[model samples]
Target: MAERILIVDDEPGILHALQRLLRHGLSAPDGSRYQVDECANGALALEQARRHVYALAISDYRMPEMNGVDFLTALRTLQPDCERIILSGYADLNALVRAVNEAGIARFIAKPWADFELLSAVRQVLQVRDLVIENRRLADLVRLQQGQISAQEAELRRLERLEPGITHVNWADDGSFILEDPGDVKL
Candidate 1:
């Protein structure tokens, strides 16, 4: 399945341009991947994001409705795993800092960004998201294995109690099996 990306920019030109550029630039190793969606405002972006699972969201900072920071904060509430990027013409230091701290932006693409850089940023953030999901999966696997191990240990202990005096059988040191019954076995 192709990863989905949602671009939210109040500028119609930037929204469509990014949609076109990203749709063409992003491709899987087999040259087939990605579904890009564009929205003109944060309200529509939020609604669309709720309906679809977006791998990454690139939003412009200054918007008429909700700004990028507010939109991102809202998005995080709905889709905590989706990666976020902020794009802005105004590189205001305060705005950037607020976006980073409040919105949890993965990347900040300045206006008039190089195509390669933009693609690279998106790729890097997606890679990071993949790693995070994989880590969580591995941790769950480990937890499951630990639970199984504990159950097996408990079963072994139970069996040991049920079969008391059954451990004295002597087998040849070399590869061989020897069975000796408890002389007066009781249940």
Candidate 2:
């Protein structure tokens, strides 16, 4: 399975560069490949987001029409489970804070970011997402198993009530008892 990733920036150069940088190297939490899509502005990014459910979205701050924070907030409405990251070129304090507080971005990456740092952040966020998904799966399995155990226990209690004095009982497929020991039986 390929995990989808969206990268958006107003600068065509930055968008292209990041797309190139991110294309081949990263792995998703499930050990799957990454499928990346790039856009030049926030509106296009939003459109893409609506069309597809992305595993992660990385957007640049200070875009012409909409900033990264607003884009991510809207993206959240479209797909709340999609993880987010903001790329801030100038260390805009207010926008960074808003991105974290309002948009619920997982990380803020500065401009001129090292390749290792960017990939590392991406890995960590995706790993967290995968862990959350796995946890939910395990919880569901536990619930199902518990329900089955409860049913079996109830059946056991009913059987006990049916033959309270019998020490052992085994039935054949045709509904006939193959073995029955009343516990007080003598040889």
Instruction: List the lowest-lDDT window of 10 residues for candidate 2.
Output: 158-167
Candidate 2's TM-score? 0.73
Candidate number with greatest TM-score:
1
The candidate that achieves the highest lDDT relative to the unseen native structure: 1
TM-score of each: 0.76, 0.73
lDDT (tens digit, per residue) of candidate 2 on 1-187:
5768999998888988888877867866566778899998888887676556688899998888788899999888667668899998788788888999999999999998999999999989988977775675566557557784464555454443233323346779998987533232322
* Candidate lDDT (C-alpha), each: 0.80, 0.79
Clashing pairs in 2: none
For every candidate in turn, the CA RMSD to the true structure comes to 19.5, 19.3
